[model samples]
Target: MAGATPLRVLIGKVGLDGHDRGVKLIARALRDAGIEVIYTGLHQTPEQIVASAIQEDVRAIGLSIHSAAHKTLFPRVLELLKAQGAEDIVVFGGGIIPDEDIPILHAQGVRRIFTPGTPMQEIVDFVKGLGQ
Candidate 1:
């Protein structure tokens, strides 16, 4: 474990969702838990997020989408990652997604979907567990 690299995660906001307070808080929590975080900021396209995740060599990608575009955007990220041969990078998401779409997103290769009011510790633990 002496030479182990710290876990890295890319937290991003894709689409026109300008509200970033939640993603920022999650980023801070992940960093405080010792995970290196790359936040791509707001209004990023799925292409930009996947490219950044691959470039940053992150273990996972956490996307926050509140624009009701989860059905399209989430899978696009997965598709892009697969296209780039980076499918090993775990993909998860959170935000104003509806309950019925949760299973759909999972089926589309999103590892997890955290809704609003989910405990921050659970997110931290999930991301940390990715390195295991």
Candidate 2:
């Protein structure tokens, strides 16, 4: 498997959420771990996010939202991916999401949800597992 494509991930911030410090840290960590990261800066819409992911041909998407809009935004991204025939792209998210909403997000097709304070290594391991 020499010279295989390095796993690519798109890290995005959706909605009016101006909180970006955490997403930047996650993007840096992923890059440090040797994963190629395409970061679509703050204030992106779900359509923009999915379009960017497809254009980048990423293996996964990491969305961060602190706008209390997870219930709307996360599913919108998943739905858009499916509609674009890119459902194979793994979708995951993190933010101020509540524990009670984790299962809801999963049921809506978000593969994983990382709440605040989850270890950085945990996120890295999860993304690395996607490559295998």
Candidate 3:
């Protein structure tokens, strides 16, 4: 396993959501856990996010949504991934998402949703499990 590549992930903030403190924290946590993280900063479109994921060759994409755009944005990313033949990249998110929206998001192919107060270790473990 010495030559094995570490799990790489793309941490993105899509739309006009300017609140990136949480995303930055998660990025740091993932890095601390030894996962490679490509922080895409804020104000990314679904196109930009998917392009980055493909370009970076990441195994997963983590979106930080606070602008109530998950319904629209998450699916667009998924669609783009499929269109680009990158559908195997797992998509997950965390932020101000309501409980009622979780099921809808999952149905749209979002692998998981972590709301406020979810532990950082939980996120780290979830990403780590993706390789298995």
Best by lDDT: 3
Clashes of each: 0, 0, 0
Expressed as tens digits, the lDDT of each residue in 21-115 for candidate 2 is 99999999999999999999999999999999999999999999998999999999999999999999999999999899999999999999998
lDDT of 1 by residue, 25-44 (tens): 99999999999999999999
Local accuracy of candidate 3 as per-residue lDDT tens digits, 83-116:
9999999999999999999999999899999999
Q: What clash count does candidate 1 reach?
A: 0
TM-score of each: 0.97, 0.97, 0.97
- What Cα-based lDDT does every candidate model obtain? 0.94, 0.94, 0.95
lDDT of candidate 1 at residue 107, scale 0 to 100: 92
Clashing pairs in 3: none
